[model samples]
Target chain A: MLNIKNLKVSVENKLILNDLNLKINPGEVHAIMGPNGSGKSTLANVLSGKKGYEIQGEILFDELNINDISVEERAQKGIFLAFQYPVEIPGVNTNVFLRTSLNSIRKSKGEKELDTLTFLKLIKEKAKELGIDEKFLSRQLNVGFSGGEKKKNEILQMKLLQPKLSILDETDSGLDIDALKIVADGVNSYKKKDNAFLIITHYQRLLDYIKPDFIHVLSKGKIVKTGSAELALELEKSGYKNL
Target chain B: MKNQNLNINQEYKYGFTTDIESIKAPKGLSEESIKFISNIKKEPSWMLDWRLKAFKRLKTLKEPNWQKPKYPKIDYQDLYYYSAPKSSSNKPKSLDEIDPKIIETYKKLGIPLVEQQRLNGIAVDAVFDSVSVATTFKEELTKKGIIFCSISEAIQKHPELVKKYIGSVIPLSDHYFATLNSAVFTDGSFVYIPPNTRCPMELSTYFRINASETGQFERTLIIADKGSYVSYLEGCTAPMRDENQLHAANVELIALDDAEIKYSTVQNWYPGDKDGVGGIYNFVTKRGICKGKNSKISWTQVETGSAITWKYPSCILQGDNSVGEFYSIAITNNHQKADTGTKMIHLGKNTKSKIISKGISAGFADNTYRGLVDINEKATNSRNYTQCDSLLMGNKCGAHTVPYIKNKNSTSTIEHEATTTKINEEQLYYCNQRGLDQEEAVSLIVNGFCKEVLQQLPMEFAVEAQKLVAISLEGSVG
Candidate 1:
């Protein structure tokens, strides 16, 4: 469902992702494990259509090249990037922003927009499933929220958006064990036969929950190795140095 | 304003000038011009004398240069001091008697001149150019003992009241602009709430400058009698003109014993063009006095237009246990300059005051907050708190804060806090990634920064002010 061919990403002439190529088919979870400076987040950003980068090659989702699409259009086209560091917007209520975003997508898709009451009901159910209260939704988006709460909120958005391609960039980095379980459960619930996920991480811990179908070791902007789910455990014992 | 990704530098939609027949005085600032304006209004001998005295003082009172703005020398002789709508010559006894053309002008300006009979709960006094065209809900307010009428009408009908309170708070010799406005002021609103009564509805006045080359000088005086309460709103707009127009107006509020007055203003004067070719030079002096024991006054303003703005809405707490509050949101975009804040003087024992200001600068514009808080020796146990925050959209813009505080009494307490922040790129990207364009993202972040001050505005004005904040920052960044 997602394809990248000879994708080269650079910022200010400094290459971050060099000749990277990866593909994830429907219903398959691909995990990219890399250490610092390994271009894991760069790959996530490049796929999400972020600016300020000199990118070469092509990215295709569902056979449609999305390199020229804007970030907002990419979002409407079902491309979701779970940021490593969520942005904090003070004064904007989280619930209002979320509803507007959802309605924007719904409008473009020619679907009936949900009224405020209906939107509230849907968000409340989703929030309860993720252990979020109405009070949290009323606060400014991510302003003064804890690390775990931010991660949970990200997953909540992912579940609501129901994007076809989800790129989880370091989603498990700062999460505690309980938060990790909640996030994994949220992602797992959104998993469908037609949807795909590219989970990028620095540790093998998250693989124990989401259980990737394929594991790849990314080094110096390229995937150096590919293996099965057991590879995560192997790396946890042997480390990437012996890969 | 729709496509956030598109660079914001859009043309001002309200820039179109309306063609109205006007009787104008010759371009100049002199006793002759002042006399001409007063003669047009057919003022009494005392009113005419008042203008002549103010004009004499205006020649000696030089414009204050302590502000942070830099503008070219204003040729006072090049501006027409009086421009009155010709239709105003025949005073309309009722709404139906008003000229259709003048009513059409107000309709296009989004000001509903004809009362719709619905409980909109607002009494509008529409002032076009130098004359008040219509005042709605006058009879209803009269039943409540609320004297709501044009200052010109007040002078003719209630001469005793007008004579007693005119220039009481800000004397004619107060400042340069105030003196000039005093000498050539045309038409404005005068409100009075009787003792032990509350105004049934919000009193509003829409001030519009229609004719080009005509400077708008308005005077607003609101007096809340003992144990009375009233809320007043003022809005201003001028047709787009290439030459810089001056709006030097004065507003005075008198809160008598145990009375409260809440005043709000939404200033949307033409901010010139995108290149800042021409706009209004809004230099206004607004001051309120808490005269009686336990009286209170509050000032809320959303300033988003004009090429240059110099305003300081102030309060003097003379009544024991009185309170004063000032909430402002000043935005400068596209080469606009603004130096605005508030002044609070504590003279009564246990008096209290609070100030909250938010300034936004974008597109090479400059915004500054200049505030003052003074506690007299007799104001024992008084308290004052001030918070000033600034937000910048692009690299070329600037924001500044200058706060002057003095406490003569050891028992008084004063606190001031200031912060400056930029519209974060990460936050914009995050919102963009979530399906909002750059414009929406910027608007969201900016509105967040100004939430405190926006909350102080009335519910209806709050929504419009939020949209104004977004529009003011449109295409500010390349």
Candidate 2:
């Protein structure tokens, strides 16, 4: 469902990522593990079409080149990136933002949008699944939410969008045990045969819940080694020195 | 790159002129010019005397240079004091007899003058150039003992009421532009709500400056009697002109004992071309006085046009326990200059006032909020709260806030808060990633910034005001 070959990214005269290649087919969950400054976040940002980057080479998703597509266009074409740090947009209600985002994608797909009542019901059921019961949908988007709550909100957006390829960028970094469990449950329920997931993280705690078919260690903007789920646990015990 | 992103390219939408014959007063402002305006209105001798007295007082006053917005040399002698459509020479007794071309002009401007097609429960008095052409729902208003008509007609038909309150709130020697308006004012609306009665419908007036080489001086006076309540709204839009036109208007509102008066205005005069060559110079003076105990007065305005604007709608809280409030949203884009705010002078014991102002400056425009809160010595236990916020877009624009506070009585409290923020690229990127284009993203952010002031506007106008806020800040996102 997603492929990247010879991806090079730079920002403001500084080269961050160089000669990166990866491939993930349908129904596959791939984990990209890397240390700090290893181009993990840069790859996520480049995939989401964040500006201020000097990019070169091919970034194909679903057999379509996404290097030149705008951020919203990529999202409309079933590509979603859950940010490590969600931007706080005050005065925009959470529910309103989610509804607009989903409806925009639905409209591009030639599907009818849910009205106010239907949207409210859908959002409530989704929130109930995420264990968010306290009227957080009406508040401004991530204005003053706690760390765990913000991560849960990201998962909520991913569930609603139902993207073909979802990039979870450090989704388990700031979460507690309860929040981590709920997030894993939410992701596990949404996993299907025609969809794929790219989990970017540094720890093996998240790997215990959502198992990946293959794990790749990213070092100096290139994959140094590829293995199975045991690779994550081994890296957790012995660190990156052996890789 | 930033300059290209911040260049606003929206052309003036209401720039066409209607070809209508106009009866114009001779150029210049002298005793004779004032007399010419009064004679054209066919006023009584006392009204003529009032204008001559105002003109005599105006000679001693100089053009006010105290405002922040700069004004070029105004050629008073070259300005025509009065110009009305020639079709209304006989004063068209009915709306049907009025010129269809004039009605069509208003229809094109999005203001329906015909009562049946109008926004139900609201009346409109349209002023074309310098004279009031038609006032809708006149019969319905009069049946409730509410007198709403042209100020000129009030002088001829209801002389006693007009004479009693003509200069009651704002005297002839109030200021420079007000003195000019009092001397040569042509037409405006006059409203009087009877004692112990609430006005049934929302009263409104639409002012248009169509004729060129003319000055529009409107004088509106509203009086809410004892135990009465009234909500009045006024909206103005002007056609494009090559030379700058002067609009010096005077509005006075009086609330008696146990009465409440709400005055709202949405002003959209032409703001010149992108380079600021031709537009309106809006110098207006609006004041309301609470004369009796327990009376209230409120002023809400959204000003989005004019090359230079200098206005301060104020309230004098004279009666004990009286309250005053002011909410304003002002936007200046592409060389437009606006210096607007309000004043609350507390002269009564236990009186309270609150003010909220939002100013947005984009392009090379300059926007300032200058407000005054004065608590008199005898105003024991009085209170006032003021909040002024300015939002700037792009590096070329500017926003400033200057607040004056005075509390003579030891027991009184005056609190003031001011903040200035720029529309950063971070906010825009966040919105853009959410599937909104630059224009829609800027509009959404600006609307959120001005939500406090927009909430104070009436429902019908709130929608239009939100759209105006978006359209005004079109390319200010560098």
Span of ten consecutive residues with least summed lDDT in model 2 chain A:
A100-109
- Find the 10 residues in a row with the least total lDDT in model 1 chain A: A100-109
Model 1 chain B weakest lDDT span, ten residues long: B1-10
Tell me the tens digit of each residue's lDDT in model 1 across A16-131. 89998899998989999978999999898888888888999989989998888888888888889999999888888999889878987787678998999999999999999988
In order, the Cα lDDT scores of the candidates are 0.89, 0.87
State TM-scores per candidate. Answer: 0.96, 0.93
lDDT of 1 by residue, B345-445 (tens): 99999999999999999988999999999999999999999999999888898999999999999999999999999888788779878887777777878
User: Candidate 2: where is the Cα deviation over 4 Å?
Assistant: A95-131, A192-195, B1-8
TM-score of chain A of each: 0.98, 0.97
| Candidate 1 Cα errors over 4 Å, as ranges | A110-114, B1-7, B117-119
What interface root-mean-square deviation (Å) does model 1 yield?
3.1
